[model samples]
Target: MQFKENQTIYLQIAERISDEILLGHYAIGARIPSVREYAALVEVNANTVMRSYEFLQTQGIIFNKRGIGFFVSPDAKHKIKEYRRNEFLKTELPRFFMQLYTLHIPMDEIDSMYREFINNLTSNPSNQES
Candidate 1:
């Protein structure tokens, strides 16, 4: 996976894992790939993936078994949604609103566009794939 410049590698890895969970790639209570395995797949250091796993564990997104591996929390989807919503509102919304204001975009137009986007996503099966 390509790492973004704005965030640390571990955090980016954590976000990628979260996205997989959100997309149902890793279902609730399902075992996630081991750190070493995932590191190889993503071509990152194992330690980085371990750090990402630790962060997820702290956030209650995943839990570690003593001798086994990490598994998604039963309420992972809910937790991820809440976490992402908070993050979007805190970080992304301000910039988005600033752009809208600078462009003199109407809220009604934004609302209409958002609705259309959602409709298209729901109607197009191909768009649902990662």
Candidate 2:
């Protein structure tokens, strides 16, 4: 719930909520805390939380119920997964590739390393295998 100074508070709030939903702290179709409640929990202004909720609604990650609090969307899990995968590909992968290039690692060598990592991970019985 700690807000980053350079980022908008509303976007930070939205990311927190997204993390909750993705972690199953907020189950699919389950009601979310009220805006005032979340604001209280995060020690932020109610307007900030409201803006976050509205942004999430626009993303189809949550839906408002008449006279009730918002609920996690029915397709929330899938939507969250898709969103995270897109983010990983768009953001994380590029950075990783950049690091590999800086290290003078060839594309084939990187592929082989990745495959070995995956194989080692899958074969390790004590690792819980993700």
Candidate 3:
């Protein structure tokens, strides 16, 4: 729950929740903690957690139930994956390409390194946690 200076806290919170969902920690249609409860758990302001929840709701990742707390949307997994894939392509891929260009790294070298990295990841079960 460490806050990064580069992004807003609410966005970070939303990302964390999305990650949990992807990890199967939060199943589809499962109820999540209340805003105040999650704030307490993450040691943040309730309002901040509320903002995160609102963002998730707007993204169609979660829905609120009257008299009950929020539940994960039925298609949240698909939606989250699509959103994350697009986000990585839009933000991270550009930075990665820039780094490769600045370092004068060839595409073939990058491809080889990527393959090695993937092989290592697949060989090590613990590496999949992150």
Candidate 4:
């Protein structure tokens, strides 16, 4: 994953892992890759991946099992959704609204585009995958 200069790498990694969970790549109660394994996959240091895992653990998205490995929490999906929804509302929505206002774009146009986008998603199921 490409690291953004503005955000810390560990947080970005945490987000990526959250996304994987949402995508069903890691089902609830499923064991995730070890910190070292994931570090190799993303080509980052193991400490960075450990930090990401720690963040996720603090968020109750995942938990470590003694002598085993980390697994997704039962309510991880719901928690992820809640956090993302809040983040989008608090951060992304304001930026989006600003852009619309700055560009003098009408709600009607955005609604039409949104509808079209939804239609396309429904029409092409494959497009929904990463």
Candidate 5:
């Protein structure tokens, strides 16, 4: 995966995993790839993936089985959505609003575009996450 320079790698990995969970790539209670496995898949060190897994565990997005592996928590989707929604509202939305204001963009224009996007998403099921 492409790593963003602005965020820590481990955090980015955590976000990717959360996104996968939301997309149903890793369903609730499903086992995720092992640390070493994921590290190899992402072309990163095992320790880095471990840190990402630890972060997810703390966030209640995943749980570790003593000898088996990690599995998605039952409420992982809800937790991921709650955390991401708040993050977007607190950071991204403000920046987006600032851009809109600076460009003197009308809300109605954005609203119409947003509605069209939603329509397309609904019509194109593959574009949406489960």
Candidate 6:
């Protein structure tokens, strides 16, 4: 995955792995790619991948199995959601708000747009069927 320069590469890699877990790509208790394998796949150094895995472990998103490889923690999905929500509030939301400010858009207008978007999403037949 292409990583942004705003954060460390290892952090971005961990976020990518968390996203994969959230999306069910890596189920709970599933074995994840080894540090060397992930480094080769993402074309990064093994140390970088190890750092990412360490971050995930600290966050309780995954755990090392000693003699075996790393496995997804049972709380991985919930942890991923919490992490993304914090990130959205801390970073993406601020950027979005700044963009609105630069565009001279009123807060009420933004709120209305958001509500409309949510309403449309909820009311869409395809989405409702899901």
TM-score of each: 0.77, 0.81, 0.81, 0.74, 0.75, 0.84
- Of candidates 5 and 4, the better by TM-score: 5
For every candidate, C-alpha RMSD to the true structure in Å? 2.8, 2.3, 2.3, 2.8, 2.8, 2.4
Better of 1 and 3 by lDDT: 1
Candidate 5: residue 34 lDDT (0-100): 97
Candidate 5's TM-score reads: 0.75
User: Between prediction 1 and prediction 3, which has the larger TM-score?
Assistant: 3
Q: What is the Å distance of residue 95 in model 2 from its true position?
A: 2.5
Instruction: Please give the ranking of all candidate structures by TM-score, highest first, separated by commas.
Output: 6, 2, 3, 1, 5, 4
Better of 2 and 3 by lDDT: 3
Model 6 bad stretches (over 4 Å)? 1-7, 125-130
The worst-scoring run of ten residues by lDDT in candidate 6 lies at 121-130
lDDT of 5 by residue, 1-130 (tens): 9999999999999999998898889988999999999999999999999999999998899999999999999999888888889889999999999999999999999999999999999999999965
What is candidate 6's TM-score against the reference? 0.84
Look at candidate 4 and give me any clashing residue pairs: none
- Every candidate's lDDT: 0.94, 0.89, 0.93, 0.94, 0.94, 0.89
**lDDT for residue 53 in candidate 2, whole number 0-100:** 94
| lDDT, model 6 | 0.89
- Mind giving the per-residue lDDT tens digits that candidate 1 earns over 2-70? 889989999999999999999889989999999999999899999999999999998899999989999
| lDDT of each residue in 29-107, candidate 6, tens digit only | 9999999999998999999999999989988889999989999998888887787788899989999989988999999
**Candidate 3 segments exceeding 4 Å error:** 119-130
Among these predictions, the greatest TM-score belongs to 6
